[model samples]
Structure formats: structure tokens, C-alpha cells
Target chain A: MFPGPSAKCARLGHFLFLRSLTTEATCAVTRTPTLPVKQATRPQKSDKTSISTAIVLNRAPILTRSSTPFETAYYSYQARIRRALHNPFPYDFYFKQGTLIETRFNLEERKRERLAFGPAFLSKEDVSEEKRAADIAAVEQLAQQEGEGEVLMPRTHPSDTSGDVRSLDRKGQRNLYLLLHVLENGKETWRFPLGKVEKGQFLHQAAQKDLYAECGDEMDTWVVGKAPIGVYKPRQTSAEAQQASEIVFLFKAHIMAGQVKPQGDHIEDFAWLTKEEIKMRVHSHYWDGIKDILSDH
Target chain B: MSMQVASQAARHSLTRFQRAPKITRKLRRHPKTGLPTPHVKIVTREFAPSRLEEHYHTTLKDDLMYMTYKHEIGERPPPRQIRMTFDPEDPYSKYRHNAPVGGSQFHKKPAPSSSPDNVVRLEKIQLHTMVKEAVANKSQLLSAIMQMKALTGETFQGGGHHAVEGIQIVRAKKSVGGWIRPNVPVGVKVDLKGQAMYDFLGTLVEFVLPRLRDFNGIILPPQSSSIKTPSSVSGVVSFGLPPSALVFFPQIEVNVDAYPKLAGMHIHFVTNAIGVGAQDRARALVSGFQIPFLRR
Candidate 1:
């Protein structure tokens, strides 16, 4: 079980305290104009002030990032130092003497030690050549009986090789964000799923609703918090200046299950892209606003 | 002088078959304390990469920051002055310790502003267990001490660090009517940090919890419970493991019969988070490590 919905409500209360403060400041700024002018223009200005909620639906890294060559080398060096300086292993406590398991462990340990310190570091083993061969064979047989050897799944997914940006499984080691290719101004533009906040709707609630409305209700998603992670304002042209000045509040949400099914014709296509890929597809101004909110890895 | 010269002359005329005398070196010691010369201190550090540590950096840090962030438009208003400080000009107060007018309102303190550096993370894990029988006979504490040592693999001041207080003896703080006496050893405790902390956590999650019967995750307090309690602000999440669950630990599972009695431990996860709602943040961090929580 997780923190109940009430916990979110309590957090929303905290966010409201700051929201009230900001609202008060804005209210004061609007009151600076002449009383008659303010009263007459208030309704028109309110109508022109557009607030929208956008969901930066994210898929967290499913796999650990592979270490760089330098990191691997450093780690191996540190491991060798640890091995050289470690306390003696209690063989009697862990394994019975003259047992096959103990013999196998010794063989494995010797191989590891030789790898760390080089072959010449150890003296010749007292055991005869035939006995050593027999021990190795017995260990191999035991390993087979226990089904010890199994190939691990490759680090890179099949979708990655195929360059499938739509597949959620494509980037396992990077934070992939859902970017919708939508018809804006009769042209295709890549952006996060965005929709205007309905009357009396909370920003976070609007974000959740917009995500499901655009991406479909099939996916299980959880919005991160009550407060928006960041905010983005679209550049207004002179022709559109008379229209509403749009403010998009971005809320982060994680998709636990299901794929994006673009609900309608408005959403032309959708791609799960990493931060770098998202930057390439979206407008530079749009990227500048949302880049910091998205994780690099 | 004549005898010494004659011996030197005789030594120069030695036979070719004569063997050379072996040379012996004396042990080096410090002149001041008369102790043997010490070897260079070697302190071992993290030997391998920690999976949980990496997870904290890559995933949990960013998520926690976003979740716990409070949007502040401007500088925070200074904390409310509950009590005025005694003036230094007042000689009466200057000579004595000045206490707050009421009491310290530490529990009411607000959380620090969220930052990347201050994201809630586990600092250390304290595993403590009180053995009742140990009060009766001090030797009864051996089994508990052995259990602690085996569980943590820590010794007093291990890894050449004086700050490392491995397994510690918890003594009774106050005298009880018939049960405990002050300064009497009754319990064992160990504080695990860095690699050891993660290792203990991994074992608990992978080997212990799943096998623990009747556990449906740790139960949360009722929704009406007060969040302003001192424990809530201390940034500690405490839970007790049943004695029967001790066997589930692989270290103890190997030699269950070695100890006469097993003791249940109270594990406290201490985190960097402090101030109001700190326990919740601590719990969030712990749950990130895959320790489950439940609401009843």
C-alpha cells in the first residue's frame, strides 16, 4: 500500500499557502491602475489571462547505466586493494574441510586471486595435476546439476537497436519523457500533453485529466506532487498579443504501466524520447523552458 | 692492546674452508615511550559500487526533490520569536544560563527549503535489542553481542577509524524498583553506515521480509495521528522485528543453534531530513529502498 489520497490533500494545503502569497502580489500589481479603468478592464483582462496544465509524463530508467571504462578500471583497482588488505576468510566456519564445495570454492578463489595479483604471485599448488583436473570436472558437474549457468539479458533492448522511439522499452538506461506531436496552428509541433484548466479545477487535477484525455485512460500514472515542477509561457506574436497570454504549469507524472494511445486526430503521433531526443524534436524556446525539469539520465 | 692486535692478525690468516658469521639486526623502538615502531595505518574504503547508493543519486534524489519542494516566490520570513533573548547588559542573566520563557519549540520548527544537497537520504541504521535476562546475569549478554557482531561484522573502532563504535553495550539509564539498575548492561546495539548499511538493507528486503509470514508491510498510523510529535520531527523511522524472524537472516540462519536465545531488534532508520514532517520524508526514502509500508 502507498500513501493515501489524503496525504496529497495535506501537501496541497502547503502549496496553497505559497499560491495565496503569489496571488496577493499579483492582485496588488493589478490594482495600480485607475479604479474606473481597472474595474472596466478587469473582466476583459481576466478573460484574456489563459492558464493551462501540461503533464510531463515520464518513464524512469529501468536499467542501471553501464559504468564508463575509466570507472570500471578505478573500481577494479579499488577492489584489488580491498582484496589485498582484507581480513582472513574463515574457511572452517563457512565450509567443511575436504568437501567438494570447499574444493570448488578454493579453486574459484585461487583463480580470482591470480587474476588480481598475476599468475606468478602464487606458488605452485601442492595437489597433483590429475587430482586438480578431477576437482575441476566435479565442480563443472555440480554446476550443471544446479543449473548455475544462464545467459543474462543484453543491456540494450531490441527496440533500441531498431531505433524505435515510440517503444517505452527503447531507452532502459535513460529517463524517457512522453512527447506528443500535436496539430498546433495547422502545423505539427512536438510538446508535452497540454490542455486548458477548466473552471474551478485544480492545476494538478487539470494536469491528470489532460494527460488521460490526450494519452487515453488505459495507462496507470501518478502525478508527482500537488505543485507544478516548472512553468512555461509561449512566446506571443503581435497578432496573438490581444488574445490570452498563455501560462502552462508543468506537472511531472510517472507511467507505471500501459502505452500511450493517442486519443484523437489532434494528437498526430507520440514518441517516448530521452532528454537529448526531446530537445531535438521540440522548439528551442520550448526546450529552454522544460529542459531543467527533465532528468539528464 | 697487544692481545687485540694478535687476534686481528690471527683472523686475517683464516683457512679457505671457514664459514662467515651471520649478522643479526636489533628491533626498532621509539625512544620516548619505549614502544615498538608502529606500522603505517591503513583504512579501507568502499570496495565496490553500491547499487542502492547509485539508485539514490540517479532516481530517488530528483523524485524526492520534486515531491517535497515548496515554491517560495521570495525570501522566507524569519522564524517567529517565541521568546526574547536575555540582554547581555543584564549582569544577572549574563552570569547564568538563559532559558526560553516557555520551553524549546524544537518540534514546531519548519523544514529547511528543498535543495539538491538537502534531499532526504538515509544517514545510518541503528539496530538495537534489549535482553531482559542480561540484567540478571551480565554473561547472558554474550549471545546478543555475538548476534550483533555476526549480523554487522563490525568490531570496536574497525577499519582504523576511531569514530567507528561498532557493537555497543546499552546500559540501563535509571534504576527500576525490581527490574533494572542504572549502569547495568542489558542490551546490544550497532550503528551501520555506508556499505554496511546498504548491505543490511538488501539482506532484509531480499531474504527476510518476503519470508516473514503475516507481514503485509509496515502499518502506518491513523490519518488523525498528530504530525507535530517530537518523534515525527526527529527524522527516524523505527520498527521492531520479531525474534522468530531473526532466523530468516542468512548470517544467523547458517548457525541458528550457536546462540542459546535469539533477540528481536528495534531498527531505527536515521535520515538527514529534520523539522516538521521529517518522519514522512524518512519513510519515503526507506520505501524507495523497497521496504514496504501499509495503511490500515
Candidate 2:
């Protein structure tokens, strides 16, 4: 319905017409939306020229085209790292490719058919311990061959890292971030879900709201006013704030889950690790600080 | 009328009969008896924030601007990405191009599978185009852009009074573009010394960049799963200095975070050049200009 080539009238008359198709009426472009629009004044021939322009916000939605990017190296790092860092109960096993796209080899066509990114982050329950471990191993093996170096993760992969598949939602986009760190104890582990800024809300409130949203069952640790922090990357920008700047504080909070219950299923099937296990099992640089986080307590 | 109706009915019947599935002679039938086959099965496919993602500003501010890195590497499409190094010393040194063109000898992956590749490829192309355009405009200089907008723009309707001063600052920065103005670089250290300009600059860098980091790219974070059946914990990802590693100076770590000394954050507005053609060059051209405030 949106900006489709077929008009509404043509759509309604599809089967009624004798010819399989009808032609669209001519339309004229009255105006155009140019970007980083320049000023509407004459250009001066002076050696040093100054042009006046207008900066308008690109109010269009983001469109994505990628298939199963999570299968890529970055998400491989994400899936393994999160599970290792926080878990209520130690995982007994992990199965890889439980969510693999089941397809037979097509000799005529040599490529593998694919599935969605959801299966990677959403189906942790179905994967057997062995499979998850194997996939982690596979990813680690690839990382190992390249050699480890401290590199800041670029801000472009989650959307374009994969080769085949388009994002279902384009331009119309919003995101929920969980700035969580892990907690440690004997037989009991906890997740300290960081708060987030709401759309148009103050960054500080967003963080508190995020904390509360994830604070189900662990409301005891709820508190506002965390220290504001931020860094500049080529792409990071805020939505509520015009320039995507930050003025909110971040806090470090922990939980006492009281028992080894999987109150949050996302937290289930995760393995508990000592400092040694963390250094060994976790592969991504993002989690390089997990041991330090746990060591605090 | 009756005759016409009868003829039409005949035509309909004939059409249905002709359209009926054809038997591959004996293939559709059993050697001894005949029966039709059954049909096949069907398959199909949250926003919660607790996760951070690498962002490509495909759409930003109001979704009008797309921020893709403008590559200086000519003719060749930009790589899917230029790895951002923990070592802030070199930002675009290893921006290798890994974006492949097609599969095998002659065929490309089907369009469905190639969307991401196409987007990455297109974004690289667009980056170059943007650079060319920006370079063309550079003869034009960083043109001052003035924006006309609705004001009291700081408050949200939900009694939230949200301050999008960042956007306001950006818009104002653009407004300055409409008139000639000199830009203050982001990395060069300057004495803020109680200037309103410096105060605004400090707020902009301190509050905006980290959150904006993930959404500025072609990628976005995976949705947070259902809480009750939280199938998988949201993946945790971070890229910062390894605390144990000895740092030659604290400034490097702070700069690693894109903090400490960076300015013109108010001017880091990008045009829609992501996942499109010839955009990388435009951004790369902009990248050539150092932010006076940000230091290595």
C-alpha cells in the first residue's frame, strides 16, 4: 500500500479488466525532497565563497536488507557471551543447529537456504549443550586463526553483516538495549539489567525505566540516578535528544535471585563460570571484563 | 441475453476444464489405480532495551539522514565494514573490502539472500557517491545549513519534557551552515572556559554519542525476547579497553571511548549515503577533516 507501483484503483480492478493489466495515468513531480539541501541563493564567483544551506532531519524510516546475519561472527560472539555472563542455574548442555535451516543439498544450486536471526537469540532453549558448544567452538576456531587483538567493535554489522536477506522493518525502527553485567555467588548467579532511556525521555529516566522493566522479581534493587556516561563512535546517536547526545547517568546494580530458578527464560540454559572458566569459555572482547565484574564481589 | 449467458457459461466451463492439472500421462496415476497428491506445509516468522548493537545510521534524527562511512578506496565497493579498532590510533587504516560480488562462475545469490550483500554493496557505493558530492561541495566548503522548525522542541507530549537539544543543537548547527561559519574540530583540546558554545559542546559529546553508536549503521540489535518465556538472554556485547592491559596514557583510553576531548559533535551530522551508491567517498571526505577536539 505504501509507495507501491500499483495504484489503489488499479489494485481494486485487477481481475475485472479483460487485459491482464492496465496502464497507470501520468503524474507530474511538483516538488522533490533533496537532502543536505543547499541554500537558494546565487553562487558567488569570489575566490572564497560561502553558501547558505538548510539542515533538515531525515524523517524517513530505516530499511534493512540482510538474511540471518546472526550466523555471522558478531552475533556468534553475542550469543555465547551473554549466556556465559549471567544465568540463574548452570546449564546442563547446549545443542547447536537445533535451529538450523533444515534443507537438503541442491546439487543444481550449491548454496544453503537460510532462516531468520530470531532463531539464534530466541531459541536458546531448544539447543542442546553440545550443539551450542560446538557452534561456539566453530566461531572460536575462526577467531583463533585470525589471532586475538583488542579491537573496538564497529557499529555497522547487526544490519549489514550478512549477505542474503532484507530486514522486514525499514526506516520505521526502534530498539531496546539491555546494558547488563553478571553477578556471582556459590550456586546462585544474578543479572544486573541496566536501565535504558525511553524515546524522548531523559537519558537518566530511560535508564531507570530500563532497570525497572528488567527488574521483574528483583525489585529490591530498584533505584534511580545512575552516573551518566557516553562515548563517541562514528554512528552512535540518540533518538530523544536531537543530536543523539547523552546527559544521563549509568549505575551498576546487582540482584539476589534468592534461588536457582529460571525466572527469566532468556537467562535459562546459561552456564555458570568461575574467573578461569570465563577467561577460557568466553570469546568476544565485549565480555573481556566479565571476570572483573564478577571479581568485585 | 439468454443465448449470451449460455455461451458465457460454456466458456467458463471450458476454461476450468483447460486449466485443470494435466496428468503426466501415467505419472499422475498409479499403475493399477489413480489418486491425487496432497499439499505441502507452510512456515513463517520485541523491542526491549537491555542490549546494545553496532549501528549504521540508515535513518537518523527523523530518519532523513543516513550515515555510512565514505571510503577513500576508489572504484572498489567499501567492505561490509571497516573494523573500528580498540587502538584509536588508526581509525580507517584496515578498512578492507570484503563485500563479494556474486557466487560461483556466473550466478549471484538469489535476491532474498543477497539483500544484505546488496545493502552493504550499495552503502559502499553510496559512500563513494556521497564523498564525490561532498567533495564537489567542498569547493563549496562545509556549507552552512539553516533549518526551519517548530520550537519548544525540547518537551515530549507524554508529560515527559524530553530534551532533544541534541537534535536542536544539530539543527542549529545546520542553520549555521546556511551562513558562513568556521567549524570547531571535535578532538582538538580547547578551553571551554565558561563559553555557552563549549557548554553545549560538552553536553552534546557527553550525552549523545554512546547511545547513537548502535543505530547509526545498517544493522540494529535483535529484539529482546518474551520475558515469561525468555528463550535466550539478550546477548551482551562491549568494546572498550581491557582494564588489565597497561595503557601508555589515560587519554588513549578516554579517546578509545570517544570521550575526554572531542568537539564539533554538534556538527557530526551525516547525510543519507548508507546502503546506497557513491556515498562512502562523501563520508570519507568529511572524515579527512579532523575534529579539533578529539585527540589520540
Candidate 3:
């Protein structure tokens, strides 16, 4: 084993000499150490450094293999590493596949069957879809009529008269968040404005994008907050559930710019609710770790 | 009139069939004679049998469609108790992917478990202080050590005691006075684990980062950056503290009067993510803890 930092540093000096000689003069080289570098001193053809280098060379494999990561090496060296503060307890002894989709070998066939003949067999779904569409269209027409009465609602902005903004109970006081509920198997479940984080986007960006998409016309008013309020994992249904689960990084955004209205078709409904209301609306199981976010409001 | 009478007749027949009490025992057959004969006593209800029957009939009539539908679907037997194995592809396979994996699609991790328990956790906070020898020459090494001690509230030990070499060459400039040599004892640093590390991280993330005036946010290295160091993606994205921000660190802020020379150090929050995918989840987990990350 490498003795310690002193011995390690001396060996590092020898390696640096070999590496420096090979490199072009002043190339602005960036060297990422395979093993976390504890400390390295500049090599001068000195006997003291050379002696340590010989020892390191003989035990080079041991040094690289056993080297504690410079980051955690100290902890391991000291043996002062503590059990992780959070989740100190061991995981469930038995694997419980709660709501995660029980994988069937013939998933493709089953999915195909559902796609091809499921509607025919399950005609109620088609009728429900048509009925839901009609209901949504009716709701849209009513919302349009309400939008026409924009003067009736409290307007936060008053630059010029255009009654497009929805009035709030408390003008400019946006303590409420818009929650998007998706229709799954005819049941509406509450979820945060969450979508797949795009190729170039961060989780926060995705949250912002989904917020606008789910909120529809009132999207302009909501200002996305920088810090995530909390991350929640919604209970997955058989449908819409993927092999790997995703997290809902709920951002603390407010209705900064627009009036509230349901925007997306996938969304069955949208509501502005505080943490308590969310707790009341969502399943109790999902509200487990999210108690902290509730206390925030 | 015929339709109404027919429906009435059906309801009467259904209620009568349900509400009527039936005999509980079959007649005992005589083995020798090869003819059936009553031998055993019949079981009878002690309570108001008619009332109980009426309740069932009324309830069943009210939810006939549901009851019939349930019966049509057939009773699902209780889940069989079998040896649970760790196979991901099997349906009803109890193998849970509790371990965090990389990529954006997976989010249902905590469904089978709870957060911190289910989520990728911040295992340990690592503090790295590198003092340049040139800077140390201007200021005493003792002063740098004192500053680090004051800043981290931990005694300097290991690696940091030795002078760090400049891996890359610097162009000769007036700022340095002359050409810089590679060998020199610059300063001291120490790594903190467990409680001490957590306490420091809390202060930095909650108080220090926010208090910095020009601070936008920390930039997270993309997945590609973590490709080489498969084990430590979180460690690789080290926090870069500028010289100006040195005074603001809680340790230094209170003990500003102790030493004159102040040096900047990088704090790398290392998570114990096992794989690339897990490391990605670790990154996402940390970000969700209100640690803002700038998009690169």
C-alpha cells in the first residue's frame, strides 16, 4: 500500500517528470488523474523523490487499485465514514413490486392486441372518449364566454384595456400552484407539471415547459422559480408507467403573467391548489416525503 | 302493460329465490338398500333468517350489474407466495430497481419506496483546498493553513500539507514577477466526512451560494463529462470558489480578523452513485434539494 500523502506525493513527482518530458512545451495541458490525485509536487532530479518513486513503481498496481478516491479516500483512510444520514436503515428485505408494471413476456403482443381490438371489445372506452371530448368542448366554450367577461375578474396588469387575463381571489398574490391531472383508465389523478427533460434541457426547464403546456392559455402569467420546491414520485398506473420510473421535480412557480385556464387535451382538468389541497386531492401514499413542501406554504 | 308485468314477475322471482331459506343437508343414503333415506340433522339459522336474506337480496338487487360483472370476471385467486427473484423483465416480478439509474425517462423509483430511502443520496461532502506555492511565497504557509482551518473548522491533515505542482505550464507574465517553477509547497487542505461534511454543505448551499451578489448558479457538467470517471460524476463537478467569495464562507466570515491572507477552495459534493445512470440520478437528486444548476 502507498504509505501516505508524503510517499504518494514523492511518487507523483517522478510520474510528472516522465509525463512533462513527453508533452510539447507549454501546451496548456489538462491532466485528469485516473486515480484521485492526493497531492503532487514538481519533480527535480532529486534522490529523496527518486527513492520514493522506486517504492511506488514496485507497488504501482496496488497504489492505483487501492487508492482511496481523493474525495472519499480520507474518510476511508481514517475509517471515519459514517452511515449516510438519510435513509440510514437498510432497504426492504423482500422485494415488493408495489405498483410497478408486472412485466409480461408478451408485452408487445398484449400492447398490439389492446391497440387493435381493445376498443372493439371495450366499446365503453370509445363512447367515453367521445363523451369526454364533447364535455371538454363544452367546457372550452364556457371558458371562452368567461374569458369574454375578463373585466369581471381582477386584473393584475393595467397598462391598456384587453380583458384576456383571469382575475385572482387575491390580486398579485400567487401562493397557489397550477396542478395538472392526467386521465388514466378514466380516472383523473393529480400530478405536478412534469414531462421528460429534453435532450438539452434541465429538470427545471422541463417543469417550466410542462407547466405551460398543461396550463394552456394562462401560461404567460406563471413565472417559473429557480429552486425546486420538492421532488415527488407520483404513483404509477399500469398504463403511462415505464420500465424506469421518473421523478416529478416540482418547481415553486406562481401565476406571474396570465389567467388560469385548462390548456392541454391530455389534461382532464387543472386546478390551483395549495399544498394542503394537493394533499387532500392526491393519494395519501404519494404524499409521504412531500410533507416538507406542504409546510412551506 | 306486458313489459311492466314481465319485469315485475322477474323481480318477484329473483327476490323470492334470494330471500327464501333452503335446507342445508342432503339425505343420507342407506348403503345396504341402495336407496336414499334421510339420516343426518339439518343445519338451521338461529338469527332472523328472513331479515338477513332480505338484506342480501336488497343489496344484490341494488348492485346487480356490478355483482354480475364481478362474477363474470371470475374470482382472482390470492397472489401466490413464491420465491422472489431479481429479474426486471418478469411481470409480477418483485425485483425492484431501487438503485438509481441514468437517463431522463425513469421517474417511478420512489413508488415502491420513499425518498432519501428511494432516491440517490448525497453520501459525503468533500472539501479540496489547493494553495499555489507562488501565492504561499507572498504569504506564509502558516497563514494559509490558519485560513483553511478557520474556513472549514477542521484541522488540516493529509495531502494538503504537501505543496501542489502546476500540472500545466503558465506563460511568462508580469503578474507572477517571473517564470513559475513546478515544485513548491503552496498550502494545506483537509477532507471532511460524516456530520462535519454535512454541516458545511448545508451552510454553503443554503447561505453562502445565495449570499454571493454576482452568483448566478453552479454549472453541472453534462453526462459526457462524467463518461471517464464512471464512479464519481458528482465529485467531478467541483464547486469553484473565486477569491472574492473567500470571506463569505461562514467559517471565514466569523473569523475574518484571525488571518490576513484568504485563499479560494473548491468544494466537491461526492455522491456514492455506483454507475453512470445512478450518477445521473444522483445529480438529479441533488438538484432537487434546491441546489440550482446552470445549464451548460
**What is candidate 1's lDDT per residue for B1-296, written digit by digit as tens?**
99999875554333111232343555467799796543566566776677778778777887788777765558999877666368656978887777776668878989998887898999999999999999999999998998988899987777766878999999999989998889999999999999989989989989999999888788889899999899999899988898899999999997788779999999999999999999999999899888999999
Better of 1 and 2 by lDDT: 1
lDDT of 2 by residue, A104-149 (tens): 1121112111111222223223657886567656655555776955
Off by over 4 Å in 1: A1-47, B1-40, B80-98
- Evaluated against the true structure, the overall lDDT of model 1 is 0.82
| Model 3 alpha-carbon drift over 4 Å, by segment | A1-297, B1-118, B132-139, B154-187, B191-199, B210-226, B230-236, B254-257, B289-296
TM-score versus the correct structure, for each prediction: 0.83, 0.15, 0.32
Better of 2 and 3 by DockQ: 2
**DockQ score of candidate 2?**
0.02
Judge candidate 2 at residue B169 and give its lDDT: 17
Task: Place model 2 in a CAPRI quality band.
Answer: incorrect
Please name the candidate that would achieve the greatest DockQ relative to the true structure. Answer: 1
**Which lDDT tens digits does candidate 3 get at residues B174-251?**
344353544454445556554455556667777788888877877756746635444443323456787678777776
Model 1 pairs whose backbones collide: none
lDDT of 3 by residue, A1-297 (tens): 532322333343455555544532322232236423321332112111111100000000001112223423333222211211112221121113331122221233344433323334323333466755665566556558658436554333352143322234321222344555788668777755555544434444455565555555543443222334444555555333323333454444444355546665767765555456667877777668455544221
Which portions of model 2 miss their true places by more than 4 Å? Answer: A1-196, A222-225, A229-250, A256-283, A288-297, B1-296
Top model number, TM-score: 1
